[model samples]
Target chain A: MAERTNSKKHYRDNFTGWLLNIPYLAYTAVFFLIPLVWAVWLSTMDWNLMSPDRTFVGIRNFTGMFANPKIIAAFFNSFRYLAPIVVLCFLFGLLLALLISNLPDRIKGVTAVLFFIPYLTSGVATSVVIRFFFSYNSAFNHFLRERFDKDISWFQNPTSAFWIIIAIIVWKMSGYYALFLLSAIESIEPEVNEAAAIDGCVGFRRLVYITLPMILPTITTVIVLASGLAFGIYTEPYLLTGGGPNNATTTWLLEIYNTSFTNFRSGEGAAMAIANAVQIFVTIQLFTFVMNKLNRKFGV
Target chain B: MKRSSKIKTGILIAITAVLLVFSLFPLFYMVIQSLMPWDQVDKSMVLSHPTMKSYQYLLGSGNSSDAFMWVRSLLNSLIVSVPTAVVSVLVGLCVGYSVTKLHFRGKKIIYESLLFQMFFPGVILLVPRYILIKPLANHYLGMILPLCISTWAIFMYINYFTTLPNELFEAAKIDGLGEFGIILKIAMPMTKSVTTIVFLSMFMARWNELMWDMLVAPDIKMQTLNVLISTQFRTMGNFPGPMYAASVLLTLPIIIMFLCASKHFKEGISFMLK
Candidate 1:
């Protein structure tokens, strides 16, 4: 009787737990899991978004994506944006973080909030202002033409426009990543820093040797986070340049948007989105591998 | 030595000052541009002329249809955000409570599956999620439902719940409370701060959300603020000043929220960082 009662109680416990988990289960099924499966199925079909009849095309959508030059260029542009963004976000984020945290106590809180305010604001707002700042007749460019005899068309030229996107991303991301990495930086013991200083470790040398290796994990985190964010960069390219100058700034997400919604080719868009995702996954894994090796080599 | 250290501090402060300007210039420029006359935005003397005409126009001084659309979209944003915030937190709380505190079969599998959703590239589901939820596109359900489940918030709750002492739950159980009662009586009240962090995080993300909002809420009558602002920007050629005004209008509520509850906002970011 005792053993039977014990088993019954255990069964009741399991039931209670599952009952609580039902909401998440049902939600994930409807939104995430089901959609994920449906996304794969949709990729295999030929259908406009509005049509009920979807012909089973079976990988033609995937094959067709490879033939498109704009799609290919968008991928290349993503990497182009990703490379500079990764480097610049690390450089500026780390340096600014070090600078801000090292400030006098009273000023530190005020400055952190001020620096972080940009991160809190929506991407659309900032992109609009940036677009204006780089417009043809803006005062800054006009000043450049008048005084320095230097005027590069930001939006009109592909290379210059690409750099503008890179600059905006770096400007927005660096401070945000700085705050992200700050917690890790704070956890490092002050004694280690004091000992490093006693060993004549200061300035850039100290940062490169002592700080960089010690915070390798956080650095990895920052890089991964920045890179992942780079993949989903729709707001900037869409709002700022309209993926323009002959699709020079069009990213993976932008191309997918165009292929699916703009062209009403939902099947092909799904295929492209999947292909883009796989590439991003592979890229992130490679990045993580290299970082891990570096972390180990640095003896962190 | 003291003088040199002071100089070093001064230099650091100067660097900080420069960074602050770099960080805030877009915002400052937006504010300045919003005040400038519409025709002068791209002109040489951009800042010389300042007027509230852009703001007045956006505020519907003449009650223009375009301005009226913007006002409606702002309402649409609030409508989308409030429910999303509530749903995300509650669902996260449920999952967090189930996995961490409750005893169940396949609980580990459930936990892992929930987390696995995070790594799946969000890019892949854009089209499919749209199609599946497309029927609701004309309704608010399409706009809100698909965007509500945040793995970040879910995991944050799970991590937080682990830190709570088990004795409270055991004591509540001994007092003849059912699992739901215990969760409601103890877990819900105790996890107030975590709930705030999750709710605000979801709220902000949903509020600023554009891609899905644009996709689902395609009806011009029911677009969100971001969709409205960006659509205006794309279609309306050469009206940069009013666009700047709209951008300011879009960002102002978030800025106000940031000032009010920056702690919760930073906490949410830190949770993601972790």
Candidate 2:
């Protein structure tokens, strides 16, 4: 009787478990699994889905991506954006986190929430505001011209346009990243800081030798996340620069978007996208490996 | 040493103050500019003549473009995002509870697949997802269906569920509660914080989304506020005030959510990062 009841309960558990998971299982199968399979197949075909005639031109699209200048530019742009973003966001985020962590408890939450507001703001809205701020005849430009006797085109020059997009994204995201680092910093035991202070490790010495190493794992997370964000940047550049000033700011997403939709080269677009996915996977894995190595080397 | 430490503290406070200004000035300028009369926008920093005409224009009280349907798009955004977040969180809760609490076959496989799904960027799936959902274009189902199952939410719930004590569930079970009963009566109540976190974050994500929303719904009637702002901002150069007003509308819902539950919001974000 006991064994029979146990078997019955097992059966019931299995039944309910699978039943509860059916929705997500079905969703994943349809949206993620099927599309993934279809993307692989489509990457090899030289025809769009809407077209009646389908032709498979095996591996041609993959090899062809390397020769495309836009693809090359995109590949380089990811790193170009990634390096500065990682460094700047790390510095700014660490600073914000450290500063906020030390604030009086009464206003700490307020300041932290205020900093996070930009993260919640839509990319499109912020882009619009920035564009208007820098547009010709705007008060900002008028101020610059009147005071400095200089006129700077915000989005026309490639280097400036690149930095502008970078600056905007950093400003929006650093606050969000700071929250992660702040939580990590707050988790440190009070005893550790007391010991460090007794050892003359106050101020910069304490931050570097004590707090930094302890939160190195979270810093790794922030770096990897910042790098990932670099690849996915589309809306800001699309709105503000249109990936222009010689395609300097064209990201993997923007390029894939223009390719698949505007140019109707779905096959090549799929190839580029697959390349992008591989790039993200490899890059993140590489960062993880390097960060782990550094974590150990730092003796944390 | 004491004087130097005071100077250092002062410097840190000064830096924090400057950072706060940098963080907030854009939003402040946008809101102030939005209040300016249409002709005064971008002409000066000062709101010498503050007016409600921009808000009125968006709300159909004045001459506004037929293409910029603020009311209709706002409704569409709420309709799509609210249900998406709710359904996604509820389903994630169920799946998470099942995977963690219930004895099952092949649960590992399902969990592994979710982990795998995270590594593949959504860009790769764009073309095929577009092809698949093109039939459902301009429909709310197209917008919501693909986003209704979030792996991240499921993972979060799973992590939270594991931390829940099994003894409590066993006691509930002994009291004649079945699986769904225990889940509804105990698990759901117990995980309220996680549920709130998941729902709020998912809602914010869907609300802020642009790329997929723009792709699936090109029609004017079905556009979200985000899509409307992105597409209309470039063309509305003559009436920048209305654009700023729309931007404010875009940000208002999220700011309210943050104000209401910032502690939970911050905790949720930090938990997800971990």
Best by DockQ: 2
DockQ of each: 0.67, 0.69
Model 1 over residues B63-163: C-alpha lDDT tens digits? 46555876788889999999999998888888888888776788988888976888879888888888888779868988888887788888888998888
lDDT of 1: 0.82
Full-model lDDT for every candidate: 0.82, 0.88
Query: What TM-score does the A-chain of candidate 2 achieve?
Result: 0.95
- Ten contiguous residues with the weakest lDDT in model 1 chain B: B264-273
Give per-residue lDDT, candidate 2, residue A18.
Answer: 94
DockQ of candidate 1, scored on C-alphas against the true complex (2 decimals) = 0.67
Q: Which whole-number lDDT from 0 to 100 does residue A88 have in model 1? A: 94
DockQ of 2: 0.69
lDDT of 1 by residue, A1-300 (tens): 454657655445687788877877887888888878988998999999886787999989989877898899888887888898999999888988899878887887678778777776678887788777887688888888999999777888888888888888888778878876776676678998899899999888877888888888999989998999888888988987778889899898888998899999999999998899898999999999999999999945
